[model samples]
Target chain A: MGINSVTTMSPGVGAKLRRMHPLPIRIMHWVNAVAMFIMIGSGWKIYNDEVIFGWLHFPEFLTIGKWAQHGLQWHFLGMWIIFFNGLAYLTYGFATGRFRRMLLPIAWRDVVATIKDSLRLKLSHDDETKYNAVQKLLYIGVLLAGVMIVLSGMAIWKPVQFSELYFLFGDFQTARLIHFFCMAAIVGFVIVHIALAILVPKTLVAMVAGGPIVSDADQSGARHMNETGNHP
Target chain B: MSKPPSRSIFRPSGKIDSSILQADPKLLYEIDRRKVIRGAVSLGALSFLTGCNVSEVDQVQSALRAVSTWNDLAQSVIFRPNHLAPTYPESRVVKPPRFNAHYNIEDVQPVDVNGWKLELSGLIADKRPWRASDIYALPEQEMIIKHICIEGWDYIGQWSGVNLKTFLERIGADLSAKYVAFKCADDYTESLDMASALHPQTMLATKYAKELMADPFGFPLRLRTATKIGFKNAKWITALEVTNNRPQTYYEKEGFNWFSGM
Candidate 1:
């Protein structure tokens, strides 16, 4: 129950818990992860040809004139996958009570305790069951970032339909700048998340096997798999 | 301890029994539960995946194009289209509205309105020049039509101008001239295929809203071509050259589409 007293449960306990995610959520999470990575990589190569950065003489696909257009094509195609995947995950989260488990905090007291324990690296395996304050913050940040990417992408893509959005970003060029920056933020966050997963083996196993070693030591029982939404 | 036996979940139930007994009980129990869970999940997922058809991308790009093309063909269809650009009332007209896009005009030397002449040259048997007054004396038509900006805003106003078709006929344009290229006073140039240039609605406007055209809106003379985005209507005319090939404009030179016709 406490930080120092993480009683090791039997080997079979990790295999018995009911999975928090249905299969749909799991598939969507992994598919979206792959799509987002490809989008970012291809996006970078395409972004190099932009006039805004032309002064840097950034080398890109040397023979191609409009690398940006091709980048846009890939980004647009990848968008379909990410959009549907996200929609499925959100519907499942709301339909099942799982949204509250990972999304809504148990209480502010738990949040405060999480921050305190995380600050000292004294959190037990059970403590990770409920997201730590930092983890919660990052999770919320990434979701909001996703929304920003969608909105800004639309603003740039269909500036005519959303005139006010053009006013918000000042112009097409400005909207494009913001969209690119938001994508970079998401990529950076994902890298940090993967590093953290590798740092904790049980977190990885729980996501892959559908249950964590802390089965007896925790209340939620289900380990967080789709945190960064990278699991297959 | 042996690893749990793996069998195709979708295979007939008969194949599963033989594979079931040769596995660890704990691992087998988890696998059995997973299989049943996955089968139910696959069904639900199939339905959900079908429901999750986010067609916004397809809708936004092709919907208007499809509607316009349909109207062009089915001329008898009576349904008023929704995406048609709105017509504005005269009372709502903004006096001295800000100019939208300024290009080569700002950097170029001004053309003398008095001495200015439109030179009809390029792949033509005869090169002729027409004065502004000469063009003004030709048969004129007036129509209060909407100028729809590609930026999603539009203004309906009166436009009085000579038909481009009349001028081309007078010049006896060469048969090989497949395009009509306009050379602007501001170093901006634009070209259109012979088909678009000869459209009855396309006019080189001289007046706006029953009054002399405002300077900011291509005063004295400008092309008021319909069926294309607003940007195609280049302002502040200086020369018009009929040609058999494509020409470029300021924006087009800077990576914009060459043919912006609707």
Candidate 2:
């Protein structure tokens, strides 16, 4: 979603909140963060069972549940939490039109310029409420990767029941490889995400509170209101 | 907190000679401390050099293997040997049923069905070789079921065969034995739990797609079931053994799950 995504709270023209993320969004964001870490840590331990390349391991210190049995327990627990949380988040986002409105006008052409600007560390403090092209791309990429990871995970866990997904992943070991790489990419993205959050502390605070402490630039900028209001 | 005297000890300065140690108690104390420190370091090295000490790698590997063993036991408990695999409609069957083996496709040689006889051994009451005619006369059934592979693909195929449970009974096999092993002509060995061997879906498949099996399809006879992966199917059957000790299959020795019950 882009800057145009809906916040749905209309507290008159000059309200206290500056029309930032709503409370549910912030709460879900924290839940997702914790879930992701658990999944990754346990997944690394499981991967250590059969090292993919030449005895390489993620190191016992860096992983959760160094033992296979205990690691799988942690993994399954994380999987359920993430799966259900994602389901609820997706359902609410699409139903309220927040997903589309928040991520709108994200053109593919702006990608290269955004990358260049990010490399140079060039940014506008005023655009904190709005998403830059690079931020939008990263968010969208993570969302897509999340879906792929889930599907590949299911295929590996239950190949017979979900035969089509198994085939899509190009076989069992191939799916495992995809799953492992997807985890690594997401981990990298999260590190960058945290660093960026540190750079822009205001955004982090807003996410924590789920309300804009700053000013809403536009009167009717959010598309969420229109999308839901029109549906009724 | 830098002390010039402490730094001079390792520097081998002649300022602290044997006569100076007797004259000054501080120098004697410092020399004794150094002796204790050196002893500790030497003891640490000796312990490591002895080779009886446990290593970090060994501990972690054992921990993981222990967990794997626990997983195997847990999986075995949940296994429902009596459960039947779901059947599908004839229209849903996948065509050109997948050909799989440890070797290349061209390397598969054809067996002479004319002189072929299904061998029997182990705890079986009847060790006589049965000709194709004898096997064909047994009561058979047909099923259209999905066959999943360990490599991550599946295909629906029509398999016609005599029910393994019935065949085992007809051959007077020791049903209570721990394992039912298939020793294939292809040199591939596969085994199943006595319960899995008696599963309703488990069969000694005689025909595929309503036709006699050819070279690629495990001609003459094949093992068919949806309970296990494709590699465990054990094609081109030559001998069947009923044994108390479960024999590990060719793939199982390669670190694949033994039960492998999907």
Candidate 3:
């Protein structure tokens, strides 16, 4: 029933039970994923109705809504979900120090090394719990893009009520352009994220089922442990 | 000559004839082909993967509609009565503002400005009709504001008319009423919340760019509010009503947000 009893009975089972992705983090991740999918698909449909560029248009198959009006409805629905869900994710990340632990301390040397290894197809995924410099950078960039998309969306949605936001983005039309570019950034991030996850399938498994529970001490000594192949 | 009945593209009441499908197999095949393609790629596949049926799709639609209604309420709550939409300089105003209507431009039936009367009704102390001259004689206010369309395009225009609040006050409208509805000569209907109707920048615009409104535009009068989307500014004004009951507007019935405040 207790942790000590479980550890005494089966140490491997006990360690595996402690997850890399905590329950809240997993839930938030999946929820945010669904919300983002809805927002992007419906947004593309809305964009297609009155395209900013004369030539560019999202194909019908890639879009969500049946028509422009239906797209607007789906967009508003997704907007509320993303707004509240994103707020919750941010609060959870900051409150629990998850962001600090997982994404911080990205040195220039680490980034350069990671890029070099990545280009050579030699970047290690031995420690599922640790994020490389490139991953951290991408995550941080996407987070900022998420924030901008919401703000720019609000500016476009209620330009008069949020006149300050409208002015911040230059104007209604400019705000739309900002929102569109933010979406593009997010979409680009998603493509790379998915491609990397597929390349290292264990990372995807770690996110879904949580690969392993690495303690703070183990995480600190992960590199030394990987080199030594130590069980304990 | 008797005038033909006006057909609303928004509210299509007639059922499609099945005979047409039988008569043209090619057309039917085309329809089926598109449906199959859509099903293979879009939400249809999603619904199938999730084991969701038509009723579940309806449930999702209803849920989204509920959120939209809540959004309307939320927007009204956040709407500042005194916050003015940013005004542009004269140079920014788009000359001959882009024309938009449910129908094509050639089909526009220009209202007879000489015979046009602003009819009033519903919860107003004054239910009298006034000629176009009466509205033109009233004290006027001008605004150079952006006209944002629901479809994501926007343009700047100069509009001048009696402030809607001033007009409603003059007509003795019940200020506490829930909605101020409009009926256009073109048979397009629109409504505004009482708060939006009373907003300082809302007006029954009579002129554009210091000139009398062109026939292609609303010839005699049109609703012009800085806060709401362009479609909410119904053109070719014919009647105004203040009422507690919500009036369904043209696009609102077609699933556009009713309180499309921007």
Candidate 4:
């Protein structure tokens, strides 16, 4: 029952997992994912209604829900979920030292070394015991991006209500662009993260079945898991 | 897939083989300031994928415009004909009402009401010009309602004026008209759906806080509706046209959503 501890279990070797992600983290992760999905879809549909580019908008196919109102409704409802969930996640991160555990105290040398080792296929640092330098940077970067996205979203949603946030982004329109940019960036992370999950089966399994699994993540998976979000 | 470079004269890169600027007037100006015009590039790549040339500006423009218009139509369809925007009490009114305009407040011209006239046209049966006194003489009603602004501000203020719904009924305007366009003396123009014009809270506001609104506020008269954002509360009114034609609003022309609902 050493799930918290990574283990290599083969068939007939009963795998009693101790740790990977606790139930709360798993639940929050999926909740966050669902909320993000709703937000992106509704966000795109609402964007279509406004036609910001002065040209082509997101084709209807990429958007979520049926109509602009439907999108608007879902987008707004999802906003509260995202806000509260984000708050909970952030509070947990800071309160449990997971925020610090996930991010900092890395030397510049370590970052350069990580890059060199990654490219050289030498940074097989995905032990799941802790995050590597690159993983830390990406996690922190994405977290900050999430915060900005929410703030900018609020700015756009109620510019008059939250004039400071609106003005901080320069205006309603600029805040909108900032929100869209952050959304796209997070989506990009989602794609890379999913692909990494494919490469490192244990990382995926660790999240799902809990882990007492093999630690020999395929080298590419190791780099990807280390580089993406060593979500523990 | 291999592709050809665009040879459009107005393209940002000076590459004109295929591009999006041909369709949108703002694209060229937008790209000049933004180092990376994300939409154009993404569309250009998408055009390449679909084997489309950027030269089809008219079709692309029409398609995008169609979507915008469709959004308007959808909103119109969903608009509750009988629904009214919520009203607030005296205490909710924000003091020193926020002043907002496209241009700075200092530049607002004090329109001379002595000879000022409210021009009327389009579907209305009466086309005679109206005066400030004529507006003041109308049956007065007061409602302290939240004025929502698209710029993201809100305030409650008691606006007293002739109820626009009653005025329209009295004027014998074609109530079935599609849009009620307001042309401001300051050159800003905006429009509202007929349904919105008939909403119970819709008023031709003459006074703010129990006194005639100063010129900086929409003097003589301005639209005061409970539901719409601030931009819809156009000021310095000089003309009104009720018509089926989808006239372009000043902000709408500048890329704001036409049916910008709450």
Candidate 5:
């Protein structure tokens, strides 16, 4: 979708928007969504040291023995999925030059203006922009944190082969500490992202439907060209 | 023109297919409900089915077995060209190193050199016994190696002993034998796969860190498996059995992975 197509629509008249997200992007988004849930679930199972599947008739003390090993195998396999998905998304974004659209420094003036507008509770009515500077920065931070998590994970996984990396991280124990902290940070960001979606329902709708769920009353709030939506 | 159904009418547009919208709203709602119920039911069924055959503990036990299986699988796939752990320079040795397990090997009663008989049985045509000096007579291999414990910490030390494979070759193990189970003086016991047992680097150490091994360290006899984890290197060695069957180590019987190695 072209940038101009996003803004030229008229206001004050309800008109359905055509597709906003390209098909490939939508597919990647959904796959990533499903894969993430599985990774988190299996990951939890692996982390719970005392949790042993005891339903099968077995003596005590044996539960931790096998459950922990297999859980790691599954976790590593899921990791590869996340790695490939991130690689594809990054490659596509860079190739299309849309990477900058997701995160580019807005003028400092724009950031200050947006913050002021938000504090004034005018954010709901504020001319909807794709992503504010603060939002872009947050996204970039999350992306970089993911890379750090993967790198630290690798250092711990093969400390011998990645001896230099292991030494740099101050050995396996230290690397594990950093990896865990990064995971917590990522989870915290996810919680905030979901909260904002609820606060701004239109953004969530836009993501799923590839168009704003423009109400009849708000049609006037948008630009005039959006009335029929044909202009967009 | 008939206004498209108002946004208030619950019509979602764009990427959501129109056919989904065209379906009767009640049917759609019912389908969604059915989907939720079916999903829950399937999940419950899976849990129950798996539960019927395997308890939570059984899965854990399976995982323990998998650790050993994964080790074996790794060995089969990733052939180590060198099959050797790195040899550190003598200067790198940690002097007066803090030792953990088997540090006080002298505490145990010394095995009578003459009475001590190394039993070779299981997947073999005949059982044989070797005197203490007989094993000592073999070419002594001296090298520094790490004893990495599962709990986490590791210590580098010198090991002076003969290759267990050399002993295996001398005895002439039966073709069926695939593992060597070390029955030790203490309650502790361990088993090694044939490839690991036969690995040229594996040794039966009589000395630790270049000193005569204290009794607690299995003086005059101890299994030193360089390729395997520390647990497999049993102290106070008493008997060595060749076996086709998967030998039961005390830990392995308790669900620890048999092959605990890199």
Candidate 6:
């Protein structure tokens, strides 16, 4: 169960072991992080121009653009980046079986247990390579939110041309509300995500520079356990 | 980095002596001195932090504009000529439709109906001017469509007038032209792509909510296209030009997207 026991190989051989995060995943993650930041900042500026809730207005310093039009320019730029980057990430995730390997089979029982342990501050961070039930749920939730934000954005952008999507969210006003909530969900997720990363700093480093490596046998063994419904 | 020397003659507290203010009255106009200084510093810091020059900033802006232009092209390609903007029930129409313009409602100059003439030019076969009476004589089409503003507000408006495509055909306009540009009485100008100009829902709207549109709400005639954002719907239209050349609109000149379709 020790780190040394998991990898009995030398440094050179350790280099050959599967990385906790592959190069492509790491690149996509960072690119998405920048895109998300730009999108959120500019989106806030756009929202402030005409707020849904009259009482709420985001501060100017926290926003990306100096004016509403300027915010629109930044928002559009961020939109293109996030759209293409997200498409690439999804493609890579499904094609490479990354989704199956990293995030799958969320049992309600396990999720409830994970939540209970998390509340008690007894949740383990022993396996940096694998995501716990809570982590899996969060990742999946944020991913869904990302997709919803984009779709709702499209609905808002072209309510006439993309009328199907517009009606899917009921109306133009409702679509805007949906887009706003999706953004809120993403911001919340990012706050928690960053806080957790700070608590367990290695997770942050793992995303940036690949963390502990798993040997071929260990990876396949983990996959076998996943398939046989014996995941620890 | 070494701190730059202070350029302001004002005190560190930003307090100006009355004698200094009297010495140069122009100093009184520098009320945003702090803001200007902060802006300049931030601009410098931004360029330094990003390792970007003024030229690079310009390059980034041009690139974004290019993307916006590309979006315009993409929208046109996907724009179904026959596809209609969603319509609403008659009950949903807002009475006394919200007024929006570059200037205030009090500043809206009412055009004399008798003196008003719809001038025609550009690629049209007939360049003759039509009076307001002539426009009213044309077959009127009515629509209760959502008027969406770029600022994200929307309202159901019941607009009724001559269908633009029908009017264009009657006026002997070259429908093949790339653009249909409008010149308004209020000095506001707007243009639409040929496809949008020919849309069934696009109209030379003269009435709102079953009444002649008020002066502040584009009286006489206006371009009311459901497919475009509210700004693209020019009010108080005085002239129509059919041309291959793209006409620069008032808002477009101010950096708003030209083809601001819904």
lDDT of 1 by residue, A1-232 (tens): 3322222222243443345444565677779888787577656655664434545433564323244434444555566677778777767767755656576665677777877987797646554456665676788788878878877876654443344564688655677778877987898899988887788776666565554222322345444333322332
Question: For residues B84-193, could you state the per-residue lDDT of candidate 3 as single tens digits?
Answer: 98998999999898899989989999999888898999999988998988888999999999999988988999999999999999999999999999999989999999
Sorted on DockQ, best first, the list reads: 3, 6, 2, 5, 4, 1
For residues B1-262, what per-residue lDDT tens digits would candidate 1 score against the true structure? 9987787677686534666567577776576777789998987775565443344454322333343334323321321222222234667555443355554435445445687777767765556677878878888976554555543345556677888777677778764566788877767787766666776767888877666677667766788765455777877787777765566567555434444443
In terms of docking quality, model 5 is: incorrect
Candidate 4's C-alpha runs over 4 A off are A1-232, B1-53, B56-66
Candidate 5 C-alpha lDDT tens digits along A71-123: 45455545667778878877887785455644665578877887887788765
lDDT of each: 0.61, 0.74, 0.86, 0.73, 0.63, 0.85
lDDT of 2 at B85: 62
Pick the TM-score winner. Answer: 3
- Model 3, which residues run further than 4 Å from truth? A1-18, A216-232, B1-57
Q: In candidate 4, how many Å is residue B178 off?
A: 0.9
Q: Which residue runs of candidate 6 sit more than 4 Å off their true CA positions?
A: A1-17, A215-232, B1-60
List chain A TM-scores, every candidate, in order. Answer: 0.69, 0.81, 0.86, 0.78, 0.68, 0.85
lDDT of 4: 0.73
lDDT of model 1, residue B11: 64
Looking at model 4, residue A122 earns an lDDT score of: 78
TM-scores, all models, native as reference? 0.46, 0.52, 0.83, 0.51, 0.60, 0.82
Clashing pairs in 3: none
lDDT of 5: 0.63
- Which candidate do you rate higher for lDDT, 2 or 5? 2
Could you tell me how far off, in angstroms, the CA of residue A85 lies in candidate 3 after the best superposition? 0.8
Best by DockQ: 3
Index of the highest-lDDT prediction? 3
Candidate 3 yields a Cα-based lDDT of: 0.86
lDDT value for model 2? 0.74
- The deviation in Å at residue B98 for candidate 2 is 1.4
TM-score of candidate 2 against the unseen true structure:
0.52
